[model samples]
Target: LMDVARLNGPPEAWHLGFMLGPRINAGGRIGRADLGVRLLLESDVSEAARIAAELDRLNSERRIIEQHAEAQAEAEALASLGLEDKGAVIVTASEGWHPGVVGLVASRLKEKFARPAFAIALEPGGIGTGSGRSIPGVDLGKAVRHAVEQGLLIKGGGHAMAAGVTLRKERLAEFRAYLESALAADVAEARHVNEILIDGAISARAATPELVATLNRAGPFGSGNPEPIVALPSHQLVDADEVGQAHLKLRFKSGDGATVNAIAFRSVGQKLGNALVQHRGQVLHVAGTLTVDRYQGVERVQLRVLDVAVPDHGPAMIR
Candidate 1:
């Protein structure tokens, strides 16, 4: 029921996952997971919705907290091992960092670097809990699982992509050492943030009603399954305008002369929007997902712009 409902709802699986599971996790991360679980398992829809909203708010707050911790982790990582350490990741903790949220940080690190990441948060009781994250090629969850099997960790279990554990405060150094040795040969990737692998390029002509239906066949893409992104050649700008507080609206004409609608959400002050605005008559590379925007009761196909690059021919000079 949840799966079918999610398929019909908002597209981000992670956010949806949070909707079902992590709302309860918010309590656990901050106060008590048991409370979060109880609110959902025991409450009616209205009560549950209130709890979920609180949890969502908490997650947003968690982001602010993690931002500081991430900076500290990156600094510590750079200071101790330098910026080039590709084989290992760091999971340090301070008095203020919460154990429940450490794993999220670890997951962020893993996603940011495309390498194994460990994040531990120091608890007031002199204990620490941690989370680890990994990508496809590197078996990060398994690496941590190996330590759990060897009894190095107090308790641990999770999926292949992410895992969690508990440990005594003093075991921090040993844990890092154990993880380092466990991943001795698996550190083969470079120190670069991995970009989303583009499925293939497409022509504006391919953006059609029938094609959109075909693409929907590959639906329910989230987490494991990703939405397809199609790249097109530079298009002529019909008009460009800003919307909301931080969105850019673009009217583009395909090579075949069909006009297309594009939106750069949350891109008002970014390089991509600037390039699009400045190069009104020029060309720019655009990457984004196919979305249907319902406006005034009509549905229109719009590109949810993700990335833009300066054309090889460079920006056009306009006075």
Candidate 2:
């Protein structure tokens, strides 16, 4: 269904995977694997709609669960590993955390701590089902599989970006030690590598639906293939506010009076979100991906903010 939609949908619509993938994945997280499959296979329109609606509800529920689990897991991880000082990986486990949501929690940890991370859901009999997420240079799957071969894990496997594990509680310490020893070098290298590549710099007036469509022709973008990151240099921040739990929404204006809307998802309470909320009217160099958002049957370009930096004090020009 998504493949067909990507093939025929408008360039902007091709990115609908972001909108639909999470809803489908929610079924698995909430213990309803069959729901995602059913939605894809259903031939009846009414049945499909019903399944879609149910999935949407599950996705919402998953978000609430994820938020709670992530908070707890992050605190545990940081306390256990002094992540703020120097930590390469965070491996945290607790009884009663949902197995389906552990991967999502681990991903959040990876982003927050800037390192590979694991979130384990310990079950009865000291056995655990764990999921881990990693930064670009860390091979989490290989590390997990290696532990399995070394008899540290009962069973586990994954790719470079993410992985899963099954193990007894007795081996938890040994497993943690093993991962730190194996991945420390890679994690250190990844952390030190900071290369920011921008596709182009455009003014607020140039950000339009036409530009978004043109830039998206080379992409049905998601995951490994992301949309472009461009800079809006020296734009004045007009207004900033928190919305939808932890997202930062902003209004920006250019010197010539052009304005644009932007958002930074899951950034509330983080550095970027706090800075945006506090620094109204500041001129900053904003970096973000261009996306088109549609509402009330109207489409407009929106910048999905990635980062912000103080503008250079020299003459104003696109860097």
Candidate 3:
């Protein structure tokens, strides 16, 4: 493997380590990621798609659970003694919150405030467990490693932006103090508001089938590897309608006069969706995930609406 990687790059090859391989993790925490492993090892596209859909459905369910935990975490953070002042936050509950969802909640909090965050839902007894998430330029996993080295934490591991740990449940207070001490004055005073990072202006003509294919090389995107966000000057909002209770589906006529359908999921009171619906014929900057959508036998690219802010304004990110 080193030789193969070296051929592609250099002779001083370094083997990347994955603490918890994703497929193994999916099985340990969730039910079955073996399906994905099998799909990958074999050239089974249809079966792979079917299995992947189940995984996506599982993730969707996980998202719902995460949202609930996040609401509680926000309140907990606010109530903590001078927690907001610390620049980093750790929210803990003695075994009531779902262990699986703590990491998700941490991620939400991090996104909501643009701070390093950790969420713990460990048993109050002997062995406790937790997961964490972090912001850009901060490595929660390394923080956990340092804490463990100092005997402040027990068993913990993760990549740059996320981590999981196990320790004495009684040590929650100790852990909190340690993290505060470790992170204090480590970060600058840059206020982080979640904003979509756009990849400059792209015309509908640039969004060709071939371009979409080429752009997809920068994918298998998740966590750190994110899909690029493309912004248009303004597409004519030919028709807009509400769908799925709160969602807004809009059909846009691009500069090439081509029709592109975009859907803003869960955007009722949401700023972008509401703005588009409230003011028809208004040009707004839309930030969204671009994807190829296939219905029946037809294939087309569509934007998975992310945020909409007034044009000439900064990008919009859902906090």
Candidate 4:
């Protein structure tokens, strides 16, 4: 599978999550539920390759399906929340949505809105299956269990960060109300404290593959152990363009004539993408984590951008 994807180098947490994990999960999401397991347990190399190819195809299909559903869900959320977006949770339901992709839609909503969100796929008989994703400090699992006990949900359970549900379409309003009331305080607190914690500052010249490897000795970064975020102060945005699936690809140049490639995933149509495009050629403060991007047997440092700021008048700082 790694060779099929042109993935070379030691597999990191990023590869596991963004590259391999999606293909593995695609079987359950939009294809045969047992395909991933079958592939894993298969001993024949040829059969395994075939299964991997099927999974890759399914994952691609899943992306197309997810993109359509996500657009609809976003529209529903906007209509429900209005321009103010004054809501603790976003609940979007549609009869046309596929159950397999609701979780992906929910996750996108959560990221775009900065709050807990649910996307439900309503069946012909008014039954719905939904998935939800929550922001930090909002205990969605606890609230789901409470709703189950209250008969608002047919069945639902998960951890603090994510969950799944079954319900009657008739009860969606009640379920939404319950979540908003129950989680409002917690969500408020979480968003209030949600600020990027920068570890240090560096320049394009200093952000080398060697430095990234040394920093990554801290071991796999994930939910509990997040990748460190560093800032590049007063770097000029050399170029910016919208790339695959609404991602913003960027190039930044430091004062000393060093350049780095960066990408803001799923930032197009968002505030951050707009800012970067609008301010092209202007100096700004960029913050993100560095990763080694290997392509065609060559490895280079790439930034997974998190946030950006307009620099206040000052001397450029490189550390």
RMSD for each of the candidates: 7.0, 5.6, 10.2, 5.2
Report, for every candidate in turn, its global Cα lDDT versus the true structure. Answer: 0.65, 0.82, 0.63, 0.85
Model 2 spans with C-alpha error above 4 angstroms: 1-28, 33-68, 220-226, 312-319
lDDT tens digits by residue: candidate 1, 264-318 = 6545545566777877866666667776544345555676666665567553311
Q: Would you estimate the TM-scores of all the predictions? A: 0.62, 0.76, 0.64, 0.77
Model 1 steric clash pairs: 28-33
RMSD of 4: 5.2
For candidate 2, give the lDDT of residue 47: 98
The TM-score-based order of candidates, best leading, equals 4, 2, 3, 1
Q: Report how far off residue 238 is in candidate 3 (Å).
A: 6.1
lDDT of 1 at 264: 69
Over the stretch 110-221, how does candidate 2's per-residue lDDT look in tens digits?
8787789999989988999989999877788889998999999999998888999999998999999999999999999877874446899999999999999999997987
Q: Which candidate is the best by TM-score?
A: 4
Error of 4 at 86 (Å): 2.1
Model 4 segments beyond 4 Å from truth? 1-28, 33-68, 313-319
| Residue 149 lDDT (model 2) | 93
- Taking all chains together, the TM-score of candidate 3 against the true structure is 0.64
Q: How many backbone clashes does candidate 2 have?
A: 0
